[model samples]
Target: MDVSWVDGERRRVTRICDALRIRIEGVARAMTSDQSARTLSAESADVPDGAYSGDIEAVLITEEQIQQRIAELAESVAARYADAEDDLVLVGVLKGAIMFMTDFARALPIPSQMEFMAVSSYGSSTSTSGVVRILKDLDRDIAGRDVLIVEDIIDSGLTLSWLMKNLATRHPRSLQVCTLLRKPEAVRNIVEVADVGFDIPNDFVVGYGLDYAERYRDLPYIGRLRPAVYER
Candidate 1:
């Protein structure tokens, strides 16, 4: 029988696993006498409908885990900017990275200020067009200051690349990028990245500030969206 993991251990796992058409051969492995072992979910896995949908093949990173990484990133940033006579400007890409920005800035040992920007490439679909546009701009002057671009995801790096180029024209002392999730294949532009939290596959996730149709951002943990919900 095909076996799959349902994000639970005993009873709950059994419930979810039982609901699927596939038979259980093992835990998250062995597609049974049917198809090959599939991942937990899909790229546009994060969803906002039904009791249980958007359960894609996902590895959840907890708030505490994210906090730990932010701490490390803050330390690294603190050391680099320590020699500067001025305070650092943290520019967060809005919506997704806002929470991380707040926490990361709080973790910094140095004095700092924050600015917000909103840019999008996804339009109304699950995939990005690779062409990014600014929905909002920074309110503070970035000239001759140490700036850090905080982002939730670094996929199809076009947006970030454009951002770097645009920011450079203003002549910031230095512009560095810090992203929570970095996808190697999705980056289309070259930019100097400072610190990265996790390297993940190109899959959609909602929660911990990320969203699926602006839903699930309140979820404490990140998860792979279940496919059955979206495949329909």
Candidate 2:
């Protein structure tokens, strides 16, 4: 055999080996990236359900999770309403928004006042009637005051739309909305929300002031209700 030919053949083999090594390293790196992404997705999906005496299917947002987000939202709110002349007024829709109103109000850095308005749309059904009536109105006049409508969730956006229009007639200096949860798919009206803690899936969720037949509101975390619990 020619010695020079043998040397050339060995050089070609070495080149092939190096190329394979580089290809294998690329594959490994890609697999690692994919695995890391999957891990993060799984961790985000697996929120821990707290020890609550309710038929919750899965915890959507834990108490700690909500509080953390609320802190961030408070910072945003304070910045937005910092230069207001009068103390900011937080108008909470009754029953459902009570929990969120209290927690978020305490989180705010600026001084604010709180009021409640009881409006009824859902009597005992999961769906809205699109007809909102004021069960209870605000005691203090909102005229010339910066009003923030705090709500637990914005499902169809109809009730909030109606509320905003109704309050607009009261002649508030400014009106804005801040909600803990919002359903993107369920929004029928173009209600501008100042801050939203979470844009959740359009599912029946109960907990943290949201309820089914006025139950599960005391649960420390927000959770998706089991089908059997609500369907029946």
- C-alpha RMSD by candidate, in order: 20.8, 22.4
lDDT agreement with native, every candidate:
0.67, 0.77
Candidate 2 stretches with Cα past 4 Å from truth are 1-54, 186-188
Candidate 2: Cα lDDT at 40: 10
lDDT of 1 by residue, 121-151 (tens): 7755467776778899999888778788898
Best by lDDT: 2
C-alpha displacement of 150 in model 1, angstroms?
A: 0.5
TM per candidate comes to 0.72, 0.77
Model 2 per-residue lDDT tens digits across residues 1-232:
9999999998778656544543344334323421211001122334454555447777778788889888988888899899999999999998999999999999999999999999987755688878889999999998779888999998987788678767766667777778888876434345556677787777798888998888889887888888888789
Local lDDT at 164 for model 1: 66
